[model samples]
Target: MDSVNSLLEGFGTAMSPLNLLWAAVGVLLGTAIGVLPGIGPAMAVALLLPVTYGLDPTGAFIMFAGIYYGGMFGGSTTSILLNTPGESAAVVAAIEGNPMARSGRGSQALAAAAIGHFTGGVVGTIALVALAPAVAALAVDIGAPDYFVIMLLAFIAVTSVLGSSRVRGFASLLIGLTIGLVGLDQMTGQQRLTFGSLQLSDGIDVVIVAVGLFAIGEALWVAAHLRRSSQKAIPVGRPWLGRGELRRSWKPWLRGPAIGFPFGAIPAGGAEIPTFLSYVTEKRLSKHPDEFGKGAIEGVAGPESAASASAAGTVGTMLTLGLPTTATAAVMLAAFQQYGIQPGPLLFERETELVWGLIASLFIGMVLLLVLNLPLAPVWAKLLRIPRPYLYAGILFFAAVGAYAIGGEAIDLVVLLVIGLIGLVMRRYGLPVLPAVIGVILGPSAELQLRRALQLSDGSLTGLVNTPFSITVYALIALILCWPLVRKLPLPARWRQRAGTSAR
Candidate 1:
């Protein structure tokens, strides 16, 4: 009841004219940027971070919430119309959505995607409203040791789960931690990695790192692999569902959120897994399984809903635990830091209006997305027709501007280019970028918690595992790290015999 009352108050705050306008602008910008090839929500938020520097924290976050959801919607648009997924989460959509487009059911695919996105986003947000407060209540009791262990788990999870090679992912994380280590030590007042430069003492701004890695790096990469030819996007009419199409979609829409939210709320469980799972689940249950590869409404609906729900789940985790499960959430976490606001257990108590308002804005954003996008999806599709060279040039320009705006220093540009190069190299080597960004953002905080835990225990290493929570989390981390080796172990004779019997 308290949560409900707080949410109603939040709706009041979010529905104010100014905040509503910001939400609208954010949705429009997010969709526009998301429709472009290779630009996902993370880059969109990073590139647009500079725009929010002037706004108050509440308004900025409201806009970010809109942008986050809008990006998911726009990615589906491209996946359906062009068979080009704007981000990895949308890849499943293209498998069936593009086929639907080719087969003259483009409007139906778009409608299913839009409605599914709405359904998943709303359900997930409601779950966040219910779960975040409870989680935050529990999180308030977490000691520094437990927090440190959790961060460690996050580090391991991202590296182990994201990419094909754990080695490359850890390598990327190391690079980010190295960048994070540049600042003066808070406890000892010592300059660890400043390299004798006063500018380095304050450390590299996360904004520069995020923008350089996502925006500038992406531009340079696209420039290198620039294709002279372009494919035309399939024409989509206004997105609307017939009664039959709606009936086919309703169940998948509900099921998608159930699969997505849990995966998204946990550490290292990204949208890719849940969206893929939703796709596979829908395929198995769908009545028209034969139409799957060719153009099944269930395929489009399930994955799209899962993607949106996963995004909301990511946000809930970010708000409650100060942990980010996805790239876009990481960038938004940085945005929170930029406002001198840390997201965690105390945040709801300290920033009640801000928290609730942000939550309410998500609901509002969903409605606006459906109302505007259902009619304007055709216009959004035309965005793909824009030439790549021009789009990338604009990205480069904004990247430089956003980087310089961080501190208004010429040296920032140099740092930006250097990081951009590193980003390009990482991409070339197929290193996943999420772990690196997570490392950069979480490294300092983890360091703080570790020192605090140690200080309290007088430097006894056992202090790290003194608590039940810490012990359990560390055990989980060990299981994650050793699971690959566990898999390589030979099966017991009985199990092997059973497996052979099953095969026979």
Candidate 2:
């Protein structure tokens, strides 16, 4: 009941004409990027952060949320229209969306993504309202020791699941921590990694680092592989689903959220796991098994819905405990700090209006996104018709502006270039960039906690496992980190009983 009152106050602020306008603009920009290929919500938001520096905090956040959801919508558009998925999660949608497009059911594919996003948004927000507070309540029980343990678990969770490999993820996190530790130590006045550089004493800003990694790096990659090609997007024929289409889609829509929400709630969870799981679930359980891979509408409907819903689930874990489940979420968390806002534990109490307003605005944003995206999708797809040189040039320009805007310092630009080169090399080797970003952001925080935990135990290793809960969590982390290796090992004879691909 108290929560409801607070949320109503949030609505009061969110619906104000000024804030409302920001929300609309965010939706517009988000949709624009969503339609463009090789650009996504994460990069778009990072690029646009500089432009928002002078804006009011409330309006800035409203716009940022729009860009986030907008990117999700846009990625699906590229996947459906060109079989080139602009979003990682959209890969699942492409499996079915591309097939639908090939069969002249392009309109149906778009409709499914739109409807799925709307439903997923609503479901995720409701879950946010219900679950975020519960997590915070649990967090209140924590002592410094518990915090140290939780942070360790969070780091392990992110490294094990967020990246392709645990070692690389840890290395990325160490780099971030190293960067984070450069300035003055809060407890002691000592400078650990500054090497006597004056600028290093102030510490590197997360926003600057985020811009370099996601936007700068992505722009560089685009420039290197830019290609121009196009067929104008097929216009939506029916625009709205027919009775049969809805009947076929109902189960997938329902089932998708169930699968997606759980995956997104896990530590360092991303949309890929749930969408793939949902796709497989649908194919294996669908009554229309023969229809799959042959324009089964369910294929397009299930994964798209799951991907969006799971994205929402990431909000709960991220907001309450400072855990970032994906690259985009990590950037958004950085955005919160840029505004002097902290998202974990005390967030609901410290800035109730901002938190709940962001929640309610998601509902508003979802409606606007659906209306705006459905009609304008074809125009958005025509972005493929854009010249490659101009497109990448614009990307580079925005990347530069975004990098400079936050720091107003030139050396930051130099760092941006170096990181961009690193990003290009990582991309070439199929190494995931997200874990690196996570590692960088969480590394120092984890380090401080590790030191604290060791001090609590008087540097005794056995003291680390004093708590059964802490021991259990560490074991879980060990198992998860070992998952890839486990998959490659031979299966026991008793377990090799059945064989069939899960239709998804």
Candidate 3:
């Protein structure tokens, strides 16, 4: 009941006229930028962070919610019309959505995607509302050892599970940790990696890192590949779905959320998996399975809904645990840090209104996206025709501006360029960037927790596994690290029984 009252109060705050306008502006800009190829929600948020420096925290976050939801919807528009996914999360949607466009059913595909996003987002927000407080409550009892273990699990999951090569991922994480080591040590007030430079004492800002890696690096890479790509926008009519079509979509909408939220809640960096799973499930259960490759509506509906729901779940996880599982969530965490706010169990107890209001804005953003995206998809599709040189050049411009805006230090610009070059190399080598981002953000916290645990145990290593939770988390991390070898092992003969009726 207390949660209910707090939520209502949140609705009251979010419904204010100023906040609503911010939401509208965010969704509009997000959709416009998101429609362009190679731009996802994380890059969009990183590019916009500089402009939000002057706004109050509540308003800034409310607008972020709108942008987040709008980006998800806008990705669908591009995927269906141009056969180009804005990010990995939208890859499954392009498998069928583009085919539907070629078959002249683009309108139905757009309608299913829009409505499915609405359903999953709404349901996921409700789950967050009901579950976040409980999770925060439970988190209050965790000790330093448990926190360290959890961070280890996050490191293992991200580095080992995300990209094609664990070696590249671990190498990227080490680079981030090295960057993180440049600042003054929190305990001894001693410099570790700073080479006697005054600017190095304050540590490299996350905003600079994000903008350099995501915006500048992506722009450079896209420019290299730009000339070889040709894309045409498909026309979308009124996105009208008949009652029969709506009936076919409703169940997948519900199921997609169910499949997506848990994956997002866990700090495993598996955001792309749920969409693929949802797509496969929909195809197998769909009555018209043959229609899948030819542009089935369920194919569009299920995966898109799963992607949105997964995003919502990520919001809840970040709010409750201060753990960011995706790149976008990592940027949001950096935004929280910019305001001198630390997100964790204490956050709910201290900043009740701010947290709840952000949650409420998510609900509002979903409704607004449904209204805007369904009709305006064709309009958004026009963004794909933007010339590659202009689009990428603008990205570079913003990246420089964003890096320069942080503390007005000329050294920051140099660091940005250096990191941008590294980012390009990583992208060329297919190294996943999320683990490195997470490592930089969490390394300091992990070190703090480790020291506390050691102090409590008089430097005894056994203290690290003093609790069952810590042990379980460590076990999970070990399993994640060793799973590749396990997969290579052949099954025993007794366990390899064929699936067939008994001959008796």
TM-scores for candidates 1 onward, in order: 0.95, 0.90, 0.94
User: How much lDDT does candidate 2 score?
Assistant: 0.74
Per-residue lDDT tens digits for candidate 2, residues 1-504, read: 766776678788889998888889988888777777667777777777775578877788788888777777777887787776777777777777877888888988888888887777678777777788778877755544555566677667766665445677776666566666768886677887888988778777776777777767777777776654444554545446778999988888878888787788776456777777787788898888998777788887888788778877887777787777877787777777677776677776677777788877777888888988777777777776777667777887888887778778888788778777777776766566766676666666666766667888899876567676667777887787677777842321111211111111
State residue 364's C-alpha deviation in candidate 1, in Å.
Answer: 0.1
| Model 1 spans with C-alpha error above 4 angstroms | 488-504
Per-residue C-alpha lDDT of model 3 across residues 1-504, encoded as one tens digit per residue: 878899999988889998888888878877776677877788888887886688888888888778877888887788788776766676667778888989998999989988988998899889888899999999878899988887777778888777667899999888777877778998899987788888888888888888888888788777766666565688878787999889889889999999888888887553477787788799999999999878888988998888889988989888888888888888888888888888887788888888988888888888888898877777787788888778888888888888888888788889998888878888999888788788888888889899999999999999899999898888888887788888842221111121011000
Instruction: Provide the global lDDT of candidate 1 against the true structure.
Output: 0.88
Q: How many clashes would you count in candidate 3?
A: 0
Show the lowest summed lDDT stretch of 10 residues, model 3.
495-504
By TM-score, is 2 or 3 better? 3
lDDT ranking of the models: 1, 3, 2
Error of 3 at 430 (Å): 1.1
lDDT of every predicted structure (CA atoms): 0.88, 0.74, 0.82
Rank list by TM-score: 1, 3, 2
Q: How many residue pairs clash in each candidate?
A: 0, 3, 0
Best by TM-score: 1
Model 1: per-residue lDDT, tens digit, 1-504?
888999999999999999999899888887887788868889989987887678898899898889889998998898889887787777788888988999999999999999999999999999999999999998888889988998898899999866678899999999999999998987887997988999999999999999999988899988999878888888878888899999999999999999888888887556777887898899899999998789999998998899889888999999998999889999999999999898988898999999999999999999999998899999999999888888999999989889888878899999999999999999999988888999999999999999999999999999899999899989999998998787842322332342233222
Task: Locate the minimum summed-lDDT window of 10 residues in model 2.
Answer: 494-503
